[model samples]
Target: MRDQDVEPFFATLQAANPSPETELEYTSVFELLAAVLLSAQATDAGVNKATRRLFPVAGTPQAILDLGLERLEESIRTIGLYRTKARNLLATCRILVDQHGGEVPRTRDALEALPGVGRKTANVVLNVAFGEATMAVDTHIFRVSNRTGLAPGKDPLEVEHKLLERVPAKYLHDAHHWLILHGRYVCVARLPQCWRCAVRAYCDYEPKTPPPGDRAG
Candidate 1:
């Protein structure tokens, strides 16, 4: 999408849902960090469901460390890669308590240095917790950006860069949430709901999905 189309695009999305937030639930930076780590390859609802019980008693590094790996495994066992996630969580917590004063580090290097915290995880923390304008290109954002011609790119990193450059400053903070939600509900992977899409007219996707038996030449 061009610079001129940026305003109306976000305006329409924002009007629909005035306040979009990450589905992941957490009380503090530590809980948010831990939640994002466990959320890899998992749904926000699932992560929230598991963390809801876990955070009350053991949200911080020291608290989670006290709970031990076995208990942590039990808490998040329902999520995919639970075993691996459990190990990473324990190790990361230990490092945080020992090295970072049990706080979520602000810099990407420090955040990524923690076990299980990759670019995407760090990006989410940076944006949601620190109010950074960074975009974390997940499967949902990836599809929506490319499909809608908002910021097409070959890979997640490229897409993120393009979005940062293309997205207007006013809407930069919530762009990730908007795009992800749009993909999850409207511009879906298998069959985009073109008819109901808010920015359907602005999209550059040619030969857009048509209604059944409504093919065009």
Candidate 2:
């Protein structure tokens, strides 16, 4: 999309939902980290289903360590790659407790040092938990960025940098959330629901799909 349209595009999204948030449920920074770590290749709804049961019992780093590996695996078994995620979470908790006094770190370097916490996961934690203007370019965000012509790039890191450079400062902090939500519900991988999209006017996608009733038989 043109630089001129960027502001209005975000403005439209902000007007539709002023306070967008991550779909993953969490009440604390640590819990948020855990949820994001477990969310790889899994749906937010699925992670929520498992975390709803796990967090209550072992919400803290120490408590999660105390829960032990076997039980931790059992708690999140419903999610894909449970064994690997469980190991990573436990290792991360160990680092949090042993190195950071059981508190989630604030810096990108520190956050990514933990197992299962890559650049994208670190970005999400930094943005959602610490109010940083970092973009966690997930599948949804990646698709939306390229599809909308907002910040197209060959890779997520490239897209992230493009977004950081292109997005206005006022919308930088929450831009990822808006894009993710739009991609998830409207500008999906399949035929985009452009007919009802609020920001369809600003999007660069061509030959916008018509509503079912309007499609040619």
Candidate 3:
């Protein structure tokens, strides 16, 4: 949490995974945008499963628009809130075709204007697709930020802002990915795997969780 510890904390993460990436599968910015939109309240694995089939059939804004609402719904029905997601995707495709010339807009305002796209989704697209140093504080990032005393805040926006301010500029671009992956695999909500954490030495959390078999008898 200290000014100095922040750098090494992220350095440790970066060392472990040199190139962190979003688990959501996509080949284009448009597909990534749609995948992030559908990923709300859903797992990356689930989204990938649905998108795997959906993308091949309708990967682009125009292709998805041509797929029609009924068929789109059927294609992504395996994901949670598929009906709503389908409707939003359809509307978003229309906007992309009409306003953005079938391209995923790079600006935050334009990206957020799309149906189903929120600040978090926009941040992800901006960071991953455009290499912008933005943080998309999802449940995983939120939990990791607070639990590790990295950038404790009451809400995602606060955490995001704090992370941007606190994290060293050199690590800003990949900070979100590193923290998200760490939270997803190590600093889990139910029980953080502190025993094997790479940055455990820098973490301010008290009474770190022990290895499974090392629990007090």
Instruction: Give per-model TM-scores.
Output: 0.94, 0.98, 0.98
Runs off by more than 4 Å, candidate 1: 211-217
TM-score of 3: 0.98
**lDDT string, candidate 2, 71-123, tens digits:** 99999999999999999999999999999999999999999999999999999
Residue ranges of candidate 3 with Cα displaced over 4 Å: none
Measured by lDDT, the strongest candidate is 2
Off by over 4 Å in 2: none
lDDT of 1 by residue, 32-132 (tens): 99999999999999999999889998989999999999999999998899999999999999999999899889999999999999999999999999999
- C-alpha lDDT score of every prediction, in listed order: 0.91, 0.96, 0.95
lDDT of 1 at 9: 91
Model 1 quality (TM-score)? 0.94
